[model samples]
Target chain A: MRGPYTLVHAEDNWQTDMGAWFSGERVVFRGKDLFTELNDFSWFKLLMFGITGKEFDDNQIKLFEAIWVLSTSYPEPRIWNNRVASLTGTARSTCVLATSAATAISEANIYGSQAELDAMYFLIQAKQAIDEGIELKSFVINHLKTFRRIGGFGRPIINHDERIAPLLNKAEELGLANGQYLKLALDVEKILLKERFRQILNVAGLAAALMADQKITLNEYHHYSVLAFSIGNISCYIDSSAQKEGRFFPLGCERLDYIGQEKRDW
Target chain B: MTKEKECITTNIWHEEAEADNPFAAKAAYCSGYDVYGELLGKVSWAEYIYLLFKLEKPQPWQSSLLESVAVAIANPGPRDLSVRAAMNGGVGGSTAASCLMAALAPGAGKNGGAREVYQVMRLWQQCGFELSQWQQHLANYQDEQAVEVWPASEHPPGFDPYGASCTTPVLQTLDHLTSLCPEEGALAYLSEHRQQLEKAADCPLAMTGVIAAAFTDLQMTEDQAEILFLLLRLPGAAAHALEQKKLGWRNYPFFGDGLTLTNDPGPAPKEDNLQGAL
Candidate 1:
């Protein structure tokens, strides 16, 4: 798909990483089904794309379902045991933040926030408008004008993002979404713009909105959102770990002071 | 492939002074003769195939062929469509297995499953904790301290179906891999967001964060981690079973008293062997 050079690479990177993971012995267990693994990997692959600022695809949603089934294979004892351990670190903390963001934003979408829960309302409205095959651009423009009087890819981080449009494009072709869906997302973006922090219509919100617009069902959206966010978090964690290591030496501290004794004469 | 040939004089190679384990048996066969001295070498996959069918050491290629078929036989049933497609499409069994293991989360959120260890590790890393810190934190919550025990209780608030406790041998290997990861940008990203990560708690994002941390700690190239997770758990388990003689190859049943049980299943795929698989 065309639009945004970054999304293409993000998608490719995700697929390549996922393919490599899929081909490795690490993911495979002897007494299990192969498809479940592929499906799980695909879901995480899309999630990684979202992390890198790409859009979600419906095929990714199917993969999410497949992941759920595979995930269910473990016994309760094992699940709880593993999860408790997983929940203890900085990783768990970040997951909390990401989920909290999602929960808060979704709540704002459903309920009006002082700044702009209206954009979420608009998203639902836009979904209805698009369902009737209305001109999405007009509806979005009206909302954008009313929300913040901004338009197009010149506004904020959303516009600056390297991967947005292509994700929307792929979503459109998968029969899972359309351009108008993004317009509604733009509406949300405009609302986020009104916030103190220049919030962008993140991949999560847009994905949730798109899935919602396609009438994918709330439960499904919840499921996909959790899985996608979790998968995205995997990439985020990797990024974070790298960051942690790098911080051991600040920019100016590249070389240590030669304070210790000089070498003795040979 | 099923029936066993009764008797044959084949040269056996014994690398070990004594056959104590599966690897020792394999070494013995590879070394060219047993203590009693018998010819054990075969030249081709076909010849080795005949030998294995006759309960002898098949040549390496023949072993590979048999392993491939055995892998095929071990794949999930056709009812699991995605797995069938993956296997048919030529994805290796070990890789597929790890992904499946990670993906094996329950919908109801009420039972135990593969705890997303890689994901958990990833999150821990993201949040600014060292692997040791994360492992310590996880250990505090676990009921058991065994090397391979499950890390938490069942029905964790947000569970990863692919996790075991932090004590897995793979964790050590992951440390090795982490030291080798090439990308520096990802590291910068983590540092930039460490505070934000550290502040999160008990949410879905946190769960993802933890899983991601594990992945990062493992220095898992996504595919490599996926494959390793899959094969590591089950293969290790299988190897243990074989060593315990809970399962046996050929007519030497686990419960049988008179069987020779001389056949070796070879080395279980350890981290190095798994890396080779990659």
Candidate 2:
């Protein structure tokens, strides 16, 4: 049967300012000669420059890089993205494929950087509500009712996330910790604890507060968080190189129980 | 006093209720018919899906094809990124939403998932209902080399990565399903020219290719095709996540045989790099 709509032709006029290739001479990244001018810059600085269309000072670069370093050490393959990376290695895939697969799978609701963006958004809204004479406890309760699960708080497997203290410490060391958002996050944590929730602000929450202080948009914050966790994913993939193909954990299969129909005639 | 409020404005708007009961609400109306009244038990889920998207119920063969497609791509095993992500999240004691998030993320990529399938469907459509036309277009595009039609990649979409022959079952399933349908549309064309296409591409017809062809034949939009693929895979991902949760938290290192603490502190930064960066 013929389709209802007929194909139409139009002149292609697509354009992009992100990056471009001009034959074999040199690549242009964000309107700058990548090989010539940007070669001396650090990868983090380059990434920031690419995203924000602005250059950063050494201190700023260090601060951002430190955030990445602090956040990139979750090498436990049980983390979703890390598991993808490890499985990629077991499949004997290339580093690019491994990292790509892992990164692709990192865009999750809670376990991924999206939680940071959501936390940032919520904190902003909470701050607004507080300014408008809403009680903090009531605001928290309302947020819980609306969102159900609070982003960037109450990590699994532990009552407190150890990374939060170090991250806050690092932010303090960098002289970038004295932000209202961080205070609000801490206050929210205090309220939750008072209410007997046992929820502490995790690294994502801390990062959200820091990013809010820096006036970073949710989009940029999410992207940066992904970049921060990328090394962990890549490292997990590399570490699993010693394992045989399709053997992530030897006992993983043993743990699985066949609960389906027992021996049936086809 | 009565003329003082002539410029009054109201903010709320209302639509007349269709159902007899004032408390009841109608969420969907299918093909000018009440969904609850006409479609609830009458149509299969696959047919309902098609009806919801295309505004018409699918043919028996189309619904059958969709059912088979869902069954075929449902579980790509635990090694698939979606399943692996769900399992990992489950092992970490994450909620079902987190697991589902991980499960959905990999569907956006070009590897054995919806994104690649959507692209292949578009490419098939662009080929314009003929095998020779597709071959000619490919040849011309290759010869020109001035503009890249597909994304800049070493391997094109609809082809598997090297050393991975994982799409066999998917293709076989597609073949079995298409055999039940009449010899027409994109599926028949693809099946007839499968050997040539594979020979030209230097790769077998991947699962994405078959799915693309099937979806195109069904006249589904790219977005609909992707959503269908994800919906089909959702149950499998949920199963994997629940199973992994049952297995409890995995404490062993991803690489070597060592039981690491769940809350193990991160490694100290290397002094040299720290100093350099600082």
Candidate 3:
């Protein structure tokens, strides 16, 4: 029963730039001492730190805080991922389970991490193309030819995205609205608007452009955005739990369009 | 702007509203079976899940096969990459859902992950028991960059890349599942041709091969096999995560020497400037 463990047998010499603990002494976070060296950092600052292993100034942190507060902290229960949290709350589930499930639901095809990542990659690559002397209009049309769907440019339900204006306002207030990637995004929006593509810059596109301006890698953006809508999710959860059992969004059989087989006696 | 869709539509599920309230469901029907009235006590959880996913009741052997594979791979231990990811969440005081998310992210990988099971399931459909087909298929695999929404194979699908030999648990699982499989069916074909299959893959058969073979015996499609593989393996991940959560990070194995900050911390950021600005 005591043969050498096959799973981690050869991982004996592993090293990480990510920090480790010192038991009761202190915790090291991204090479900074949690209590001493990084004692002044806010939770938002620490969140960015955890993602990039770098620190941010107070103003920049305030800008990120504005993004965090205004961008996707949606408290709406009807939102797909938030509904999962609401359902979990209605069922009297644990916080971790509820948030995790909701976060998992956030990986939907059109929305969530996958779409966000796609948008960021597209923005980064498009900027590279623009830098390489490709005209914006020509590049936009050519990029459209490669795939039927391009993320970060459109809202699924409404042609106009309501979040874009608020985010832009915040970015303007923070004095970061005119960054190169943000300008590119707005320029692309103009092209699409003039050409009648029926899609506008959604929150993801704006956020992606802002992130790209900061040169955040796709992986870092993904990890950083994991909890994008947690505020809304937890709010939905709280509201649902405070109400009644199994009562988030109940639907009648008559409401359902069951277009399949009929009942049969087995 | 007008909303795109109308009311929700479904082929697999319908719930009858109570006589008094349209919002309250009195009974549920799954694929036209009275789930609460007719099927709840009559069928096993395994059969119930099969009916829910496949939209039909399973034969006894099919349900049994599904249950066996599900139980076998239920938890691959905290040492498994997926399970460890979950444990990482649990030990760090992350939410339970986050632990499962941790499980799914790495668990969905092609390296001994559910995606590998999906890839292997597709290969079973393409190759069956034919070793020559497997050899050709594995040899000629290419990346077309098709851009799937969910994960596909990241590498060759069937075998373990890191192992020195076929692990004992994998062989044992294959044996147990082989007993449940039809004598001449998918599991049998796999069990008989495992050596040749290993040779073709150029690595020992991992548990994903066995699980995928068992799913093949149940006639699960590649996509179904992929998702079910994710669902079935969550139990172990959740259990380990919760256990580690209670054990605290100190009790958790942070590695033998533990993680060290090998790189020196860079200069601290200035007061009015972001550190990562280009």
Candidate 4:
């Protein structure tokens, strides 16, 4: 509803494609009963339905959930995002804030949602280019030259991504491994392996290809994946909250490599 | 074990370890300036914030300019989506971090939030004071689609496409910020040629535009502007959230009849057939 605006677009009522609460009567979710009809649907399934306005099979839902359950739940507070959660907990801060800060940090460029989204877009575009008869090798090189970094590649600190094999095994187990995007991804890996040994298919690359194969639009993927790191992050928050204050890997002051202006008189 | 962690870090923060406890900070410094010993109580928040980003103390005018922009962004009120999100967290008995995260989630949007300011700051980097370049850039904005990660701005980054007019606050901010800058500064250019910029973009000037120009005048990196925009505006969200926490959700401006929910499981708003519903 329009709160304070004189613009023409300001309307009296806002429309939602999703279902609504009938006060004390019942709840609706995408034309289905939140209680009666879809009560048995898993949370991930419900979340996906709400995000994309479409129902997914249990197998698909399981695969999606497994991606988070297996891979994202690092539980290590040293990860930048999780570190915030740990700090919040150690500070005796609330879980909500810890999760919030952690999630916010998860929006980091290199290893977060933006990277995944960028990689997904690049994969989509790269696929189209492949279809258009652009040589995959040249397209890959040109993309590297233009973007400075390829979206789906680059797993820092480690030469290989440990997550890819498990993800592939899981996908194969679910019979969802046969995707063209995944194929394209492996083909790109072929080039990277030959040319740049260190650059390998990261989880972002694999996940992007899999989601692309699932035909999950960028917007849909974004909404569904916002809570991607919540499990591990929230765990750190709660666990550290129970520990001695500020004791989650407490750091000595000597660790800071301050490279700013030297201390001076005011 | 559910999960497990570690770390020490920062360029902007340093601590001299007490002789007894190395883990405990005996003295804190922000950008090599002593925090408690020197800068605190002496330096205004605007000056300190400026120092934090620019890594140097700002001149009086620069500090004043920064303060003016910070004041403008400090409280966007409840109607602003970010503040509303914060209020929701406050009223709902949510954690302060959650509340701030809620605010930041929307505040990071490309529409009228920090991201908008960031893009405009970048536009400033690209166009500077050349109205012709701005006009040309807005006209040929599609060129940004090439290597840029964020969505290529379809409209000019700073101006609000939905705003009907250049609002009073935006105009006032432009006026005030212009007063703080040199005659040849970015704010000065914006103040002088806002109409031309507006006509080129076909939208009214917004606070974001003013902040972008002022940030440009302050010589802040676009990345810094983006984060600072979110941070400076948090005071309002946080204050409102605290206020709303006291007032409770009942008084927290619910849009009754404003939300028309579709696909009701029980029945439509007009109909009342309830067979399989809970």
Candidate 5:
């Protein structure tokens, strides 16, 4: 019998050392035994290892894991992803479907984790400009003029993100704070605040700064940030599953406003 | 001997920069037509959009359908995910673009926006524009217990979730708009099998379905149809974001205190052994 038909050129095969199942035997993950060595590591450590291909010390793990723990598990189900999960739960959908659907929705450009990646990219550029002796205020002003919005700065609902101080404090406690990216993030915030922009470094901004400090590549930065938020999507599904059927904001016929042409014969 | 690798090529751009200046003075062509001389003020925005996508100008009916769809699905208020996200972004003091981006994110889902419509169009096309064939296919899937193929419980993409009795304004508008078009086979077929389709899916046809059928009738590809839907929804998203900004920042509490509950009760207070000793 012939092997599976090949579509791509053999030389162009993508390579990976991530992980692979071995039928009934043990699994290999990042050159370690999945059931023994890798299983002993914290999920955050494992995630970081997967993305950066490097191991971290205890303090680094603590700080990184704290950021994920703090950001995960949003209480509000009204958010797009959460709402989808809730709806799925109300309809008694499977956990896999619920989480998959919700996570996909969470990828929306506006408030999704991708925004964090964009904000981080902006910060990287802004920091480079600053390193070139461009005034922070001038740099910000120019950015605002060009893009009309600076990522990782202003949020939508609150004047300040309550998550910033605590994350910063955690970073400080771990003695991992005061890196170049963190300082730059603070400087940007100060300039924006001085300009009465009312923008503060949100959790996304801080996460970007920390990830940058680790010298994570652009691709890893995006992947890690998304992985950090997966918990929230899962929690949404779990929470929604506990709810009664047809109870997730069940909209009646009256709720639908009809302003189109009145009844007409086909 | 191994063959040499084939290099990907493109006609989209030329090496000589001087040969191609899209925005150059008095020398601009959109889809190979004189934009300044022939298209300006002569073609409506809808017709221009059609020209850009199809590389040809649309018929009166096509342009009319495009314009109608664009106008109809523009805004369904702040209740929509994208609009709500935009509003939330506004309240958080996010820039207009960031808010708009949030609105666009959830639109990629099967539940809402153009993607869902595209899925419906694909299914409809697979059925060869025949209602009976589609029904039979759905029934066969049902017989095999393939709930994933067409889950009747949830709003089957392109159908309103809030029961089949209620009619969406956009769907109604689509009905009138598509009726005017010369190529009304898709719309007519949908109308003929409305009851059967609704019964099979357990929901009424939505604006997404109507738009999908209309696009099919216009002989648009799935991608083109989806893009048209996105274009139609963009203005509505912008409006919602603007309105939220105007309304000022408002707190979006996930749920009231009354609805809050603990998932675990701490192992039933350690089995009351310490309490009994106390």
Candidate 6:
């Protein structure tokens, strides 16, 4: 399938200051004792890059900024997952959708400085809005209750996300969104759903991704997709970790035997 | 609003408590729910019922709505939102919603985690040798102090304890696993690597390669394959991350750079090589 956006692959060592895409802007190291904190940030960056090929986008970066604010100034529990984890379906979904949408749209809109400037501006704005007390209509709720027949407030996995949309909608009104990427995202959503369903599009994942397209880089999207599915494995990891009293996946001689045996069965 | 907040918080706490059950809890599993196919393809009949009868996560009536959506999607006559949601992961909307978009696209390969195992296997095959030989060579290479390098004996360097190389359990497990592979070709590959494994025991990637190759030979579903991938890749990713974290490096210079074949460069690729079969 044709990627909705363009991917300009560059060779290693070219050292282009793709503007805000630069490492200094991308990698922020903040904590007490620069020497030790620098060590932790390097690891965190490695872990983050392994999960998502791209550097932390504006949302992640903004989250790190929050961490930095806490780290250097006040110090709090890692704020990124804190806020993200606390969010239920609609709000959480929208936050992910909106932020990922911004990154892709801004980058695709203009490469280099223009892209970086646009990305940073929108991100900084969204970060500020979240800091303020504004909340918007939950898009997940809107989609669930109205746009899609099966989505919304009553579903068991996501009961609390009803409040997210209002906050996001209010944020949109405050010019947190340029709206063009969202509009185009909707168009792509329509095309994808039409292909999936063999008719006009429904507000399904394809649509959500089209929405995500406006925010995340394709590689980032791939990471999101992988992580989403890996949620199942996360449960397994948690189970194994709990049993071991630490984070570990038990590897043993017998289990290894079972795996190898299965492979050669055919 | 206060009442609603209280209710939501109470419910969240209750759900968290109930999520403890591994077999029954719907709380542990998130639905990509389906509207047209199941609910828009977000929740499925089995899952909704699971939430109700098994998990009891929500109020019964409220949970029933999720099931109704699941049924609507799976109606089968026409592919509706319910069905689309069911079809989200695989077909008929039972698929996860996050996974739905990629599944809809033709070229977005179906295998995700299972393919990682296959990749490690492909890499192993690329560096040709029989699985048995590979196991022995690495075991000897790693635990040289523990045992003789390559006499045709039951106990080898990797078999005994006290090898400077830490992953002895991993190598032994792979050796046992290689014996189980169905194809003789794979067995032959194992035979070729026995000696080389003795020479370079320190290579974690090679050790990983042995474990990965052995695991790939087993029959597994896409989900199972994914579980294995995470299990194996975690060590490598963690090691890379750890180095950068501890060393305070600019990047994971060790990883992203191509892996070098330490033992033999192996022979020229032939038509019968496992790489061609894949």
Q: Best-fitting candidate, measured by lDDT? A: 4
- TM-score, every prediction: 0.24, 0.51, 0.81, 0.90, 0.50, 0.26
Candidate 5 per-residue C-alpha lDDT over A89-199 given as tens digits, one digit per residue, 9 for 90 to 100 = 788876655665676666555666666766788778888897899888899889888878877777776777888888888999989887899888888988888888777
Better of 5 and 6 by lDDT: 5
- Tens-digit lDDT track for model 6 on B1-278? 35421121111111111244432323222222222333325554544444423333344433443333233222222122222222233322221322332222211111222232344454344444544545545444332222111122222222222233435544454455455454554333543554455344333332334434443343233344334443323322223223334444333232233322232222323476676778
List DockQ for all candidates.
Answer: 0.01, 0.02, 0.29, 0.51, 0.02, 0.01
Candidate 5 has a DockQ of 0.02
First chain TM-score for all predictions: 0.35, 0.85, 0.92, 0.93, 0.87, 0.26
Q: Is candidate 4 or candidate 5 better by DockQ?
A: 4
* Candidate 1 local lDDT, B1-278, one digit each (tens): 88743332333222322244422222234222232233334244434433423334444433443344223223323223223323222223233323233223221111211244343433344334354453344433342322111233432222322333222322343333223333342333333343343323221122223223334433444343333334423433333223323222342222233222132222334568767798
Q: Per-residue lDDT of B1-278 in model 5, one digit per residue for the tens?
A: 99753332321111211244422343335545566666787889888877767766688888887787777778857778767877777767666656666776666456667777777778777887667777765444222221122222234666665543637575577568768676547777777677797666665667777888888877789988887777667677787777666677654533222221122121112347887798
- Candidate 1 residues A1-266, lDDT tens each? 22235444443232222221223433322222234533454645545343332334557555334333332222221122223223322233443443333322322222112112233344666678878997766665566566553222232323454334555666655655654555567665664466433556544445445544555444334334343223333334333444543332122211222232222211
Query: What C-alpha lDDT values do all the predictions have?
Result: 0.36, 0.69, 0.80, 0.83, 0.68, 0.31
Query: What's the distance in Å from true for residue A188, model 2?
Result: 1.1
| lDDT score, candidate 6, position B66 | 31
Error of 3 at B234 (Å): 4.6
The digit string of per-residue lDDT tens for model 3 on B1-278 reads 98643557888878778999877778878898998789878889899889978888888888888888889989988788999999999999987777888899889988888888888887887787788998877766543333334544544677776656789999999999899878988889888888877776667788988898888888889899999999999999999999999999999775656445675364444565565564
lDDT of 4 by residue, B61-132 (tens): 999999998898999988899999999999999877678888988898777888888888878888887789
Off by over 4 Å in 4: A1-9, B1-11, B139-154, B265-278
> Candidate 5 overall Cα lDDT vs. reference?
0.68
Ranking by lDDT: 4, 3, 2, 5, 1, 6
Model 6 TM-score, all chains together: 0.26
Cα RMSD, each candidate: 26.8, 20.3, 6.4, 4.3, 22.6, 24.7
